[model samples]
Target: MQALKHFRIDFVITAAVLVVAFLYDSWAGVGLTAILIVVEIVFSFDNAAVNAKYLDRLNHFWQTMFLTVGVIVAVFGMRLVFPFVIVCLSGSISPWSALNLALEKGDPHTPGTYGYILTEAHPAIAAFGGMFLLLLFLDFMFDEDREISWLTWIEKPLKKLGKLDVLSVIIAGIFLLVASETLVHETHVHTAVQMRSIVLFSGLLGIILYLAVSGLSTMMEEREAAKDHEFEEADAHSSTGQKVLLAGKAAFSMFIFLEVLDATFSFDGVIGAFAITPDPIIIMLGLGVGAMYVRSMTIFLVRNGTLAEYRFLENGAHWAIGALAVMLVISIRYDLGEFVIGGVGIAFILAAWASSILANKRDAVAEGATDSTEQGANV
Candidate 1:
């Protein structure tokens, strides 16, 4: 009963969101979205485990920021912005025109059916996928923390660069800008001028989001401090509140960071999804819902301690991340469709998770047998 009460809010929120989505659409779109949610949730099991390690360090206000702002961006921002940038770089239309199209029709998936829409999809998409894939490969191969990761040498030297908070935000902005512009020119889809403007605008968006999260965090801290001073000595509180506040903030930042990570993962995912259906609405619906489920599941894992108990869960998630990164890179250079990406990525995690479960069972059985033998010998 007590546990239920603690999680009642979470349950209610989830239920409400589902109800609303269901009410909004009942046919192909909603069904597709549901499937996406499930797929995303399953594939992202490891992500949640990894996320908890950071979320456990944040404060509450940030936690709230994570659930709200983080969710919105994860569901809409990336899904919408990425494809638009692709359009802009292709020079199919101006940035303003692309935005108008998406708003008027809600994310056109294919160039042909986009109402004779001026689109720059062709080579830019290929280039975007390629760059995304390259990044994925480097991340998977060089990421230095997967139970003895590959790039510890660089991590320490990089740590000396100072204020990772600021640096990470800057890097994210730069990536968005470069990704938008580079894809446009390399794909030969758009003019340099158009691509440049798109990159600049997208970079600005990144900067604004970073500032919003950070500024909100600072304000929250100030408010918390004032609250602390108001209490008398006998009625004083322990630092648990402060700790939770910190954990929430860290969690929020980590949540956004993970979303960026998720976006990187989605580069291939979205590309592959198009193979299934060219409808932008369906694609967004599917991928958006999937991201949502993954995000929720991540929160569940942190709260449940499943990862900590399993021990091998983190390894599995990192392995999944690494694999997805590689897969994205490969897709960039080749045409490894959705089935391959989804199948291979999900299979790796499932195999790893199943292996961990079996190992745990074996260990438990061995311990039980040993204890029984000891009891008999003592007897």
Candidate 2:
């Protein structure tokens, strides 16, 4: 009963999604929706941990905002509207036209079919999302203070290279250019030159989006730090109002981060859904349900402090993200199936879990040895 209260909205949303799933009145439709949802939520286990890092830092009011308001954004903004926007920009259609095109869907090869349009726009989608995710992985790799190394041989060298300024951007650009060229040669597109232009511009937009969001957060953190310094000298403790105010600021920034991160994670799910079915409503319902559960999982991890207990869990998620990034770029030319994508993500996460267990056991053993050594010396 108590647990139900926490997941009440998620329950409602899930019911709504299943109803939407069944709206088409076809077994194939319903099944595809279910499959996409499972794919999204399973592959996004890492996303939950990532969101918890930021979501847990905020106050109850802000957390509630994420639970409520964030869902609307995830469902409507990313799942429904975002794809439309993608097709609109790439296909050169108005919003109304895009909606009509999506609704009046035909065969996959048929012009203006939702699947066709979305598939056509894959290069741009892949470029934008790949750049965003690549930056994310690069930043994590370059993080000097990161202690754990899932791939130490590669990570150690990257960490060293991370010392160079804007190296991530440079590497991402090279990949983007290479990927766009690959798409020109490999993918069935309208034109090589046009695809290159769209991809290059979209990839740049993605890089800008990531830098802008992260820069804003860094700026806010700096201001918050300065405020804390003043508080330290001015008073023994801050007032409730001041604390709430700080929390609000932090939450606002985190809210932005959460939304963008959610979008980045959804990139693969969005494209991968088309492989199952291209009906926008079906994709939205299925992926939206998955998004709801992912958000719920994020909140669960935050409240349960799951990341604290499983230290390397977050590292595994990020590594999975890096792999996903690579897959997105590679998929531009190659038809890397959803099975491959989801399988790789799960493998990284499980490997991380196993590594965490070993680390904890080793830590316990070391602590025991140290305690015995001290006791023997005392005796």
Q: Report the C-alpha lDDT of model 1 over 4-110, residue by residue, as the tens digit.
A: 66556655655655565567555555566566556665655555555655565555565556566777787677666677676565445688876666555433344
- Please report, as a residue range, the 10-residue window in candidate 2 with the lowest summed lDDT: 237-246
Model 1 sits at a Cα RMSD from the real structure of 7.9
Q: Which one wins on TM-score?
A: 2
* Candidate 2 lDDT tens digits, 1-379: 7557767887887766677667774677678778878878887887887788777777777787887899889989999988888888767878888888888755657766767878887877777888898898889889877787777888888888878869988999898888777665434546677767888898999999999998888788677767668665676455434442336465588688878988888887887787777678788888888898888888888777777777878888888888888888787767798889878888888898888889899999999999999999999
TM-score of each: 0.60, 0.89
Each model's lDDT comes to 0.53, 0.80
lDDT of prediction 2: 0.80
Steric clashes per prediction: 17, 0
Question: Pairing residues by index, what is the TM-score of model 1?
Answer: 0.60
